[model samples]
Target: MTTAATDTKATGATGREPWGARAGRLLRAVLSWPNAAALAVAAFVAAPLYWMAATSLKPPEEIGTHPPTAWPENATWANYRDAFTDNHFGTYLLNSVLVSVIATLLVLSLSAFAGYALARLPLRGKAPIMVSLLMISLFPTIALAAPLFLLMRDMGWLNSYQGLILVYTALNVPFAIWILRNFFQSIPKEMEEVAWVDGASPLRTVLSVILPQATPGVFTAAIFTFTACWTEFLIALTLNTADRYRTMPVGLALFGSQFTVPYGTIFAAATVSVLPIALLVLIFRRAVVSGLTAGAVKG
Candidate 1:
């Protein structure tokens, strides 16, 4: 009996050792190859943005010097001060903020209702409507440029905030609807049923139960919409030719044209341009992550 027990123990140990060894080898291989490659790619991508920030801090002479300085000898706020004072950056910033915020709010509100209807209501031609929206999203905005330009001209909305807001909202709606519809569909019907059982109306149920759960999706939608509107160049350039009405993109273009590409000032402006969106993302990162994860899991 002792001899038999000893033989069984040896066999079990041998089997366990090989399996553990194989698992370790597999883990090492994964960590060494694809994971390492991904990290390297991320670093490479981030290098230019970091360089831009660093260059923004350098003196104009240093910026233009042969063999560029990776690090500034003496950092200064001169570039940023010059950027705001010389470039009319303040006005451009305000315009961008106003247009982006209003457009995002409108898109979110409209898309919420449209998404909920598509998700829950049994409307005629729902499939076709969704397909049409998808197709419209696929069409390049450049294709609509000439017609949209003519329309804006006819409406006398050229160089106006209203025109830009209208265009931004329209462009963002299809994406907002797609995202919010997926979110609404993921929400369990049981919650709504319970609300209804408790004598809540459809609107009340949606307001009290659904909207709160959909915050992540809403945040995601708002971020994307705002970013798109804020950075849009082609439409803004064609629609708003007046200096006072120009948003950041067109303003930045004008800034570029004013000088021989003042590297420090341009970088400073670019850095400032990135701050608002970065701050927004950081503030709502948790919601964004949760929304994205939930959407992926449910889908």
Candidate 2:
């Protein structure tokens, strides 16, 4: 047989591997050790979220079924209605958004300034100060909760939005400052030199020049600070004792009473609570990854 004819016959009429062979190869690659491990990890992480969503849709009676169902047999929106109307979740959601946004803004503003100063300024005790910030950030939140409650009460700020905002900013600032400081240090110094040569003031240079390059770092800090503020239960519970001032986490906890627990409503509220942070992280995911890795190796 001619070489061309033999080649086509050995392969297929198309002169390529047959579809069955390609399918087999693809399956083998998917079931490879690395890909299988990744799938396992993803499923592990996603299992709780899937369960929460499924539970949120389940009917009240089905929530405690003996030998629980993998998927809800009878899904209903009653839980969502209960979450929004019966539980006054809308108010709590609004409070959460208000506190989280304001806290994130304040954190970003303060951290940027502090980070810039630490990264670029010629100052005394910089190392000690950075170390102190790390230590403060690592300090347990439980330890500070009582003291902060007392401080807020003394200032007549308890049960007020400003109380939570201030506390959130303070608790999250040190870590944010650390992230931004590393990112700022990673930025090329020559850029700042050029800005200075052009007679841009320090604040002006940061706003116009350095900040544009540090967008990822800003987003990273914003997401982290916002997530922290959004989910913090201990401080929110301690400070905002008034029902009107309660945030999402505290509100979700109140969905159950001492006599009976409303699993469906609690699950629905939790699902809603996760949405904002999940959306925020999804949108800023690239920036977060870049910001985290960029600071690892200084330019």
Top candidate when judged by TM-score against the true structure: 2
lDDT of 1 at 4: 69
The sequence of per-residue lDDT tens digits that candidate 1 reaches over residues 208-260 is 99989899998988898999998999999889989899998788777756457
The models' CA-based lDDT, in order, is 0.87, 0.93
Error of 1 at 215 (Å): 1.3
What TM-score should be assigned to candidate 1? 0.85
User: How far in Å is the alpha carbon of 6 misplaced in model 1?
Assistant: 27
Superposed Cα deviation of residue 254, candidate 1 (Å): 1.6
**Model 1, global lDDT:** 0.87
| TM-scores for every candidate against the unseen true structure | 0.85, 0.92
